[model samples]
Target chain A: MTPTDLRAAFIADLTAVAPDLDPAAIGDNDHMQDDLGLDSMDFLNLVSALHKRFGLPIPEADYPRLATAALAVAYLDQALAE
Target chain B: MSIFTMPSLGADMEEGKLVEWLVKPGDDVKKGDIVAVVETQKGAIEIEIFEAGQIGALLAEPGQTLPVGAPLARLGVADEAEVTDPVAAPEPAIQASRAAALPAPAPAPAAKPVAAAAPGDAVLASPAARARAAELGIALEAVTGSGPGGAVLLSDIENHVSAGPQPAAQPVAEDRPKGKPGLDMTEMRRAIAAAMSRSKREIPHYYLMHEIDLQSAHDRLTALNADRTPDRRLLMGAFLLHATVKSLAKVPELNGRYDVEPYAPSGQVHCGMAVAMRGGGLIAPAILEAQSKDPDEIMAAMRDLVARTRSGRLRNSEITRGTITISALGENGVDALIGVIYPPQVALVGFGAPRVRPMVHDGTIQPRLAVTVSLAADHRVSDGRRGALFLTEIDRLLQEPAIP
Candidate 1:
């Protein structure tokens, strides 16, 4: 899948968890938790959604790689490639 | 026959609309089965039955607004011999056929066959399990039962779903009516107003605040969550909740309800976590038997409670069983909040946002992570001194964070 598709998937999952989130306003570098105000539970939901969507194994250690939109999309892109 | 009445979900809720029924006549239901969804001031709550029985008749219709304790349904004895008897058999069979014939009734059974089968051959499953099975398109007969007398439970269905092939990425959003447009905030505001008004009118409240150094708690939490996944990680709120529960044990007078003239202190702590809903409203459902749970368990329970509360799928006991409430301001919220006690309960504990501040630690002034802990207790049940001790115990507990 293209980076654009991965970014769209990320936004869709994020908005599902935090319904009030403004998707268009989200910057690529904005921290999902700190800047976007997703709590631990909400962040977990987002990760679970991504895992369900892409069918990738997101280990606990690699959670830091998905911290930001840019980082998450890049991580997904690389994980999908390999 | 026993009547399943509309339960008082909270002190604030006086009436609720019977939004939908999950069970029909002739269906076998057990204690703790969610038979109906009632739209209260707090939103759509899945109403659980308190007895094991066969659903005999639905006394109320969908969309009919009824007061608390009004009969919602009639439950007949689950005994086969009793149901087979000529006297007991005909009424429910007739009702069963009538209910089955109703347009768009859930669990749409073949009208004649279910009535004929009544209490004997009907699948023994909780309404929640049935609903989930219907959602996932899993046949209930295919799933093995794990509950009492081989009843197919929600967990059993969940296990079945997980063990089988993955279904399409259909969000479980359909399980809840997302069309309600944010849980009727006007009704919630009214509920809050009534409860707060009653609380202020009846309970003589005494407020106390203590600034606790959260340096130890913060460090411990960071260390704990470093190797853990997002799902397994603990929040500072859990630590605050744990400390509050432990402190409640020390000051027992502040731990229970004051419903009648005499104050009754409970031996157990059902700590109510005040969670703000997504659209706009607040509901504090208790973490049942919080005394036995560690910080990790408390965090899990809090997460589950928050999710269910936001989804408007809370059980009746969760709303009614709170002994004391704990309200924590969000990360970006103000420094402190003096909360109104959710009455019948005598006390409220508030945790403000933790911030770095210069404090006198050991000898010299140093920057420490600190939070303000506030308590609003009923003056009738306990004095300001006991409240102070409760706050002090919480401070001590937080300073020496529990290993778990």
Candidate 2:
């Protein structure tokens, strides 16, 4: 899948976590903490999900890159595009 | 909007004939405030709000057969001011009238009334059935539940042979006979059954025993009681509890369980005192935080536990959750004994009646209290030597018993 396709897939998968959530509202700029109500446990789970879905070594030290949905998509797009 | 559940009015009621909504769909509710009423086989009973959420929609109409826990009303506490009523509701009269018959209703009597507890009845019954039983002066013991969740049904009540209006059960009986009229196990007994069942079934128990010279303990208690008023004087049970706590501090191993499954970890060392009710069945009412609590606090907790055990109005939460137990049979005059390990508890200290036996204490034949301590344990969870060390620590503390 293309970088754009993978980013889209990630958002779609997250929406499935809580089906009641709206997809349109969860854009690139949406911070996961705000848009998805991701508490610490949920945030950690989100990281785990990202690792298993795409083999990307996003270490705990580099977690700040995942500041918002848009940044996460951008980072994943860059890595997958390479 | 979530609809709140309507409580069953009487035990005999299959479905409570909706009396009136104490609050409409939009009204707010605290945890325990009464919301609605349902008619059971007996009479109209009030139901209380369980979840601290908003009533979302009304599934059951004014008169509907709510098979116990079946959602009568939807509660939306997680989401506020979001009352979403379902467009299509289920049948009312047809469903209620065809309602499966449940056991008859029983309201607690004025004396030994159903613990006017804040709802939260025993499991295996519907909310409607539980409320109805509470109202009809009936105890849940007689009812049989048939709901998918094993909830007691109105039909169960109808089949139940009413034990009849039980005499008023009072916590403090009037006109006490000179000797304590062997109090029956009405309240404390039930608490023991529920609490012990939960603990034993869920926890892997280990036992610990230690024998100490009861002569010192007895003398100490006698002297203390002699100085104080008869009512406030010290009891042997109080002293044992005190020493038990002190000893537990030394052997932290006895303070918790060795849950090898990794799922089970170190358990807390709450002490359970095996209380023998006059009539029958033994109950081990626990002393919370026995290790940290002082002698006076332990004494008070023990008093409260014994009193409540006799009263039978004990909440289920209080009955269980002790990591260890200090079971004494000295009151009944038994010598040293070995008790069956209460599950999940690593050890039990069985103290029997102190005998007037000759002892070589520091190379002297002095009359000593040879109280036997039996340590019962579940071998799977604890090693015999570890269990023995726990008993040794208890013995050491009991012998010393410093006032703190």
Candidate 3:
């Protein structure tokens, strides 16, 4: 899948995890916590969602790389390529 | 036959709207089975049946809002003997069916509320009243009786909990963060206001705080998570829950509710963790029997509870029967919290954000990861010394990270 498709999928997963967030308003560079207002608990859930959708375990160390939509797409691309 | 009434979800819930019934007539249900889902101010909660029986008929229709204790269904005995004579059995069955077909009637009006009696040594009190008084650290001599025959009621004990904290409600309201628009938070706020104000006005609370060094636990958690994936990784909350339950075993008074009568120490620990909802408001549901689970199991339960609660689905037992409660502010928020004791409960434990701070051990100062732990306990049931011991036990238990 293209990077754009991956980003859309990631945002879809995020929206599923946090129903309060508006999908249209979410920007590519928006941080999940600061901008979208996901609490630590919600943030953990987002991570869990990503793990489930990709069928791969996400390392805790890689959490920082997936902070924003753009960054999450980039991280997913690299992880998927490897 | 037994009438299944709506169960009380919490102290704040007045009534619930029956959205759907998971069972129908002639369905046999065991105790603890979710029979229906009711939507309340909190959210959709799956109502469970406490008796094993076959549902004879549903009295309440879907989408109907019913008050607490209003009968929703009629249940027939599960193990009733089958009639052998076909002719005789059909007659009895027809009669029984007629009886069950009748609509449920409105509950009888409650007895008139008696006015509080005058205060004196002659004041009569319920066993629960005396127990609540002992739990709140209040002397019953000053409280006026409100029950029949000039007996003191449990409400009286709560009403006499503290002398002056009652005045802080106004200022606290002024300082509360305003709710975002479009999300109906008024009812939620009012429920919170009533419960917290009642807690402050009635429970004689004594506060105790201790700083715990979490460096060892932190390192151990990191080591445990190093090779694990995000889905399998355990959150710090699981450790806190495990430690809290273990400590309650040592300090039995910290567990159990105080109302009507002082119950013996709970046989199992139902540790309630406060979960903040997305729109507004909070609910503390338990991870039942936390003492029996390891950290990993606790984490799984915690995740499931939060997810289900946020998704507007919870079980009946989750909202009630909490022996103790824990409120953790995670890693970003406040330094410490002196939470109000949720009523009927004897104690509440709080955990502030875990941060790195300078520490002195063996005469050398070094930066260490630490968190502030605070306990707001009913002064009537346990003293500050016992509360301190409870916190100390948590600190000691966390260091070893052993779950047997």
Which run of 10 residues does model 1 chain B get worst, by summed lDDT?
Answer: B81-90
lDDT of 3: 0.75
The alpha-carbon deviation from the true structure for residue A44 of candidate 3, after best TM-score superposition, in angstroms, is: 2.4
lDDT tens per residue, model 3, B90-154:
12333344446544323322323322221122346887887776555443544656789668789
Candidate 2 segments exceeding 4 Å error:
A1-82, B1-210, B256-260, B263-267
**True-vs-predicted CA distance for residue B273, candidate 3, Å:** 0.7
B191-242 in candidate 1: lDDT tens per residue? 9999999999998999999999989888888778776655577778888898
lDDT (Cα, 0-100) at B213 in candidate 1: 91
On the 0 to 100 scale, the lDDT of residue A52 in model 3 is 87
What residue pairs are clashing in model 1?
Answer: none
| Model 2: fnat (fraction of native contacts) | 0.00
Summarize candidate 2's per-residue lDDT along B1-404 as a digit string, tens digits. Answer: 23344343212223334544454444456776667655332123346665676554445556444544344655556444353423323544424443454222122122222232222254466667666655653445435567776667766655554644322221343353221222333533443565457556665555555557777667766566455432344556667667766766655565554434542433355787776543346656467667667666776777666655543233222343566667766433557676655555566677776677787788889888677777776555557687677667766766664642
* Alpha-carbon shift of residue B93 in model 2 (angstroms): 16
TM-score, chain A, candidate 1:
0.96
Ranking by TM-score: 3, 1, 2
Give me the candidate number with maximum TM-score: 3
Error (Å) of candidate 1 at residue B133 is 42
